[model samples]
Target: MTNAAHIRLLTTLEHSLDSGQQVVSLTNDEDPLTLKDRVDRIERIELHFPHFTDGRAYSQAYLLRRRLGFKGDLRATGDVLIDQLIQMKRTGFSSAVLKDGVDPADAQRQFERFPAFYQSDVASETPVLRPGALEKPE
Candidate 1:
């Protein structure tokens, strides 16, 4: 589904609770609660990017998945570009809402280029160093 079709924009905490539907909102600079606390009750949490230059949402997506252990869908909204689709997916965003003028088909094409999982070490417990880092072979 398209990001615009699935995402809830400018959604407030109270409104989200009342609607009982998944919501995604922009992070205010002064919020004291942790990301986990903010999204704990919601079925899905989305991070917003007001502009391409503002990248705080990327960090939020990473924290929501890697640190807070959020399993539900994480989406990216606003100023989303075709170039950013792959990186956004890699950072843990399951989907995104592109800007008003952009084409969804382009975004879909970008999303298809990368594999589902990007990190090689995610499946392994130990860190793997370079081949010649330890010693030379005979």
Candidate 2:
């Protein structure tokens, strides 16, 4: 989604809440707006997907990117699937941690199969039908 060489894939993480790192980990129910006051100090935010069907993180990611203007790494953690990578990127996730046994190579291939999308998304505001729409956002 970032048009980077490849999608960032992590095998695991130790939630940063107790470590005092610049990372913030939030559950699906947590409001991203609560972090608005200190978002600048944060370097990365990990949003959890308790279940594959639960998608509250998508809205949270949108708020962090569009409303809060967070430019740091937005990672998807827990129950992440290869099929969800595209939408996750479109919704503002910069990286994802694949569930156990999920092959990163196969996950990366998903992007190669669909290099472009027709509709506008968080990564690109312009629709492909419009001129300069495919240009990756800075």
Candidate 3:
């Protein structure tokens, strides 16, 4: 029921999962909601930004988190940069594979540059200084 051309093009989540690979890739054109029904089988989802300006992956990451409730690793692979790491984290990317020439040390510095966030995102449950903002409460 399968053809070599199709098999060469797409391996599918089911096949990857069965092969013991926990991670999967999603292009910008691929709708994140399409995975909502298959989230359980996905352990990690890699969202490709393609270009730093191409922000469709952020929405994909958001939907994967808030909608599909994907809690596993959300990795930013394509066009990854220090300038976008924070936002990527906010959008639920746990890890990122930066493009060449970007130093990992600089990435860590960027993460530390902002002590708190102003808006609620997947990485932060609440805005900074707001009630119940990363605090146990008095």
Candidate 4:
């Protein structure tokens, strides 16, 4: 697996596509640009949270799905924990690269622990909630 920590923006990514640097861009808390702006230009984006306590990356992933409509590969690359994998997939990440010293098998286990469609928006054959509950009270 590639070391995501080594990934960097060699130049203003939007302007330097021809550089062919095999670069992967990451966004931290100070990024002024929106997820849409970043994803629109780059082929891949890694969402980086300096610590597990910081959750801004989750919101960024949510926006990438629900707002930005980014369809390319989205990855979680810093301070990642196995417990977060399910939630990360729910937020639209396709893959995750764990922090240094974490086992790759553990990361693979995170991907396989849940079914592919788990927590997705696929419609069910039967509604678990009563239809009446879905309607406003008159």
Residue pairs in collision within model 4: none
Using lDDT as the yardstick, the better of models 2 and 3 is: 2
Q: After superposition, how far is residue 114 of candidate 1 from its true place, in Å?
A: 3.8
lDDT preference between candidates 1 and 4, better one: 1
Model 4, C-alpha of 24: deviation from truth (Å): 6.2
TM per prediction: 0.63, 0.84, 0.77, 0.59
Score residue 85 of candidate 3 by CA lDDT. Answer: 74
Model 4 segments more than 4 A misplaced: 1-26, 30-38, 116-138
lDDT by residue (tens digit), candidate 2, 1-138? 234744577655433222446889998889999999998899989899999999999999999999999998898988999999988988999888888787777888888887777888888887667877578999
Best by TM-score: 2
Better of 2 and 3 by TM-score: 2
lDDT against the true structure, each candidate = 0.58, 0.84, 0.70, 0.57
What TM-score number comes out for model 2? 0.84
The lDDT leader among the candidates is 2
lDDT by residue (1-138, candidate 4, tens digit) is: 332322111122222343333335557664424444555566656688778888888777777656766766666766777677667766767656665566655555654555445223311233355457579878
Q: Write the per-residue lDDT of candidate 3 for residues 1-138, one digit (tens) a residue.
A: 122111111123323343336678899999988777779888778888788889999899899989888977676777776788778777877766656666566667666677686778787797866766577767
**Candidate number with the higher TM-score (1 or 4):** 1
Clashes of 2: 0
Superposed Cα deviation of residue 11, candidate 4 (Å): 24
Per-residue lDDT tens digits for candidate 1, residues 1-138, read 344322222223322343337665646342213656656666666577777888787777777777777767676766777787666665667656656666556656664565344233212223355456589778
